[model samples]
Target chain A: MHLLAAELNPLGHVMDRNIIGGPDALLMGDPHGTPIVTMHMLTLLLATGLLLWIMNLAAKAITTGPSSEGNDRYLTRGRMAQLIEVITLYLRDTVVKPVLGEKTNKYLPYLLTLFFFVLMNNLLGLVPLLDLQHIVGAFLGDSHFAVIGGTATGNLAVTGGLALIAFLVIQVHGLRELGLAGWAHHLLGGAPWYLAPIMVPVELLGMFIKPAALAIRLFANMMAGHTLMATLALFGLMALSGMESWIAGLGISVIAGAFAVAITFLELFVAFLQAFIFMFLTAVFIGQLSPHDHEHEHAAETAHA
Target chain B: MHILAAEGNPVAVQLLPLVTTVVVFGIAFFILSKNVWPRITKGLDDRDNKIRDEIKAAEESREQARAAQAEYESSLKEARQEAAEMISKAKNDAKAAADDLRQRNEQELADLKQRAQRDIQTAKQQAVTELHSEATALAASIAGKILQREISVQDQQRLVEESLRELQPLK
Candidate 1:
């Protein structure tokens, strides 16, 4: 009876498709624990591969020739290579280098990976890959491989996993850059020693808060956008087909359609923006972990005195 | 449709997904950091450094060119000043030479004029003395011719007076 009802009510079907499935939809059934493959894992793996392939290609294309050769404004050969070079250089020079001044080089690779991975996942979400999977499954007699769709970053676990990684890198840097005594001083928040108890927890909480912001911010942005898009499309679909006459439905659907298009465009912008924010914020956090500048501390001391 | 769709450990993270994600991302990061990143960023850095070196070299060359131009301009100015000095000295020397030549020519011309004037004066004096003697002889001869015989002192005086009267017209 439930199955028949599910089939009859298209709205229920769409609502279920759009919002009802929770984290469970993010996973794919892998019965055996041996092969730990799921939809998010598949997308993650794909993103990693795509990044590797493109980066290698870009590496191969960049030139280090003498001045006697061709134009030298940019480093790479092709358009795609130019795009990659610009992104990498902009992020390194403008974003990463400014914040993490001394150790920009040391942690650049991970940062680059993070930015590209998030960006790729976000862009991939924009494509109707899930629809393609369904079409492909309908053509094939089964839908097992339809797992290759949806926002990989929309999964809390995936974003959480990335945050956890960022968490590790930030802490590790704090330890390395600040050292034992300096790190202890860092915990004191530059107040008198009596304030250690109050300040320590805030500093520690700050450590998690930064990465948590990264994870939640990414997950919410991606998921909310997709949800809104689905809801808008549902509106258009309902408007176009649910009224007394086809013309009436069509007239109303146009408004919904326009709104949907606008939001979709907005969603596209947000995808890139959120990914950039995640990267930019990570760099800022890592930069904060460096040892407090002595001159700055001295000036503060003088001012206080 | 999406809600009914269930796979793996539904809603909960299973062992395999976590492991796969870690493994895949790990491998990707490792491969990238080790193999790709070093070469790529090195290429980028190499290109960056190379371009910077080239720019520095260009700036250095520009500086050298500017210095050389300044030196050349200064030398040119010096040469012009030297040429002006030489030309002015030559002009001054030429003017002095011309003035000296003019002064010498004027002195020689004045000396010639004086000598010529003195020669004319002496010639005129000699002519005057000779004329005086010639007149006296002429007067005696005239007296001799007119008296026809020996004459007395009064006749001689009368003849001399007549001769003086005739010479007056000649003077």
Candidate 2:
């Protein structure tokens, strides 16, 4: 009949609900009138709190000596310092200041917060607990050895919401700067009168596409990295399962463990990279909404006149 | 079982993400738009400035303390040098005084010795002349006793002259 009746695979269990169809799929919300909450969403909120706590504590406990003392020392250096300083500087130099221009200092804080919120969310997704089995096992302790994991960004709906926010902000800023008529005209790609009809739909679609692309890129990367790691883990596990002797299983598991560890580190890099990519793209999109480079056009018009 | 399941129409597990996404997104938007993003940046900036100020103050204090210590050490070194020079000058002055006193004592001793030698020579000449005169006087008395006559002036002059020549050779 209509394709084979699907068998429920373990992948299906870890998969998030599909809202829209295919690559454009949005996250499925709750049927009981509750909104959908992805792992990434929870991760985002948690990361935001953690980031603020770390940053605030860092500021509060700041000391000038070669090393800080007591609680301040933990806040000021090592992992926390590495995390805070790297993300802050990245957002400031790459995202806020460049796109928003010299007048963007006021918005630097919001952008920085956003950058960290997204980055930490993405990074936390790579942590071991994101797996179903691991969480269950952690709760159960020695009761079970099973582990399950998933990437939050694998769901299109969550990324879609983020994109939508960026879209809304972009439009709001553009409208504020360009006014209503100017906003509409700007949407028309500022093409000649004869070209408006041809350009309008494309430009409008482009607006949605920009956000859609963001949602897809982040979702795909997070999903793919996790999927690859999971696949490799499964292969190692299968190899161990087939072994008759304990020694052989141990040998295979050791190798697999090493492989898993290597993949995990790579995924960690992917997490930060994806977040940076998202933030950078968002900045570029927002930058476009600012007043277009019309000074050159104005000068050209004046010369022609 | 199928009929009961259909009648219940319980939402399946696949739909869980959909429900979760909406609520989380709404909450995220509300929190982020309303409270989080607005104050978070300002809070961060204020904190950064505070840290910078603390660091600056600490550095300034350290610098001041270091300068004070250096100044104290330099003054101490200067004091030690001055003390050494004073000791050396006092020692040199004492040595010069002792040398001058020794030379003066030696000169006085030499002058006294020359004066003593001169006085002894004069005394010896006078003694010799007196003895010779006495001898001549005794001989004349004896002669007078023997021949009823005294010694002459020329004989007395010749005796005095002979005593003076012998005393000069002894001196």
Candidate 3:
């Protein structure tokens, strides 16, 4: 059982492993000797850079300057650029705009960056780059070496950091929209002043919990999907170690490989799903504090009618 | 299963990655906000406005075309009405002129017939007078022959009167 545990340890694949020099390298270590230039960090940086390049291309394809002629100028150029434009418009017009209203434009960039960045990292994680690196490192007599490739969003620290930013943006927006007194009044949740004692603390705790939930939800989902993939892959090796039968091993490998393939496709869907959820929830939180003009207009129209 | 038995913290939140994410995200956000979003929003807006303007222009031109067609139809109707009026007026004038010409021709024929009748009456009167004179002269010659002497003026007059009475019945 212990042997199986060690052989099938899925965390080894999902966990952040060091790349380049060890902790002894310059600017590489904290006081506790945790390597700063770890696999997840590298992935995060790579995803960010990728996002920048993609968005720049999308921007160029989407925009037609003044003095442009013909109806074709309105069309988004290239399939990839069109796809990006569609997604951006969907999120802006459907997801965020209805909630944020006039403030949708103000918050769109941050929301878009969050969604694409997380999605990129999630997609990159699904690639077999980490496994390839491991195989290459084994040949070089360095089994633990990794240059890149891991789920950055799968990391608790990374998701927590994202949640932290979302929390800050939501709170800052709330403060700006409501001011100090109105913000406090919101904590009361439209209840009487006498209930402030119970409501204020609950509301305050709710604020922290909202972002915390966001972090855990994203991190657990990404980590579990990756761990499942690793586990299925290791099943074949485990079968070989046990029975020493070539047919048994091959059969288990084939079955496990098929399951792994299905999981990969599922993971692809989850990557986009998770990104959308994160952005949508963040927008919801922002909308909670800043009640938009559309809602008031609706109420006014209803009253008139 | 190994997750339960794994050594150290399985879900540890490291300081480095957390900090790196915030810093990196902030940089990305700053760059994209400055460069990308505005242009895309503007492009969408421009397309929408252009479509609206085109639809409005098309509608206006359609209205103008409808108005022009209506005006043309009205003028065509008026022209037809004017032509009908002119034909009716011409018909009336032609009829009136024909009636006047017929009346003038009848009046001229009557005047020519009356003049011929008057001329015939005068010719008859002149012929009667000549006959009477001839008869009287013949009677006077006969009387002179019987007596074998010249006749007087009174005797001649008496004989002419007697001859006129005798000739009256035969005239």
Better of 2 and 3 by DockQ: 3
What digit string (tens of lDDT, one per residue) describes model 1 on residues A1-305?
A: 45433323322211212111234242442333233345566677777778788877876676454567556533567988778778888898998987778789998988887887788888877787766775787678644236666777776667777787888888888889889888777877676889889988987776678688788889878877876776666665676656778887887678767887898899889987988888877787777677756456434433422
| Model 2 spans > 4 angstroms off | A1-14, A17-52, A58-82, A130-149, A243-255, A294-305, B1-171
Q: Where does model 1 exceed 4 Å of error? A: A1-35, A61-77, A141-147, A181-206, A238-244, A293-305, B1-11, B35-70, B92-171
lDDT of 3 by residue, B104-159 (tens): 88788787777777777666656666777866676667778888788899888888
Summarize candidate 1's per-residue lDDT along B48-140 as a digit string, tens digits.
Answer: 787899899999999999999999999999999999999999999999999999999999999999989999887876775567557766767
Question: Backbone clash tally for model 2?
Answer: 21
| lDDT of candidate model 2 versus the reference | 0.59
- Candidate 2 local lDDT, residue A133: 54
1 against 3, candidate with superior TM-score: 3
Q: In model 2 chain A, where is the ten-residue run with the lowest total lDDT?
A: A1-10
Worst 10-residue lDDT window, candidate 2 chain B: B4-13
Flag regions of model 3 displaced more than 4 Å.
Answer: A1-7, A20-34, A65-68, A291-305, B1-10, B90-171
RMSD of each candidate?
Answer: 7.5, 10.9, 5.9
Q: Identify the candidate with maximal DockQ.
A: 3
True contacts kept of each: 0.37, 0.07, 0.72
What is the alpha-carbon lDDT for the whole of candidate 1? 0.71
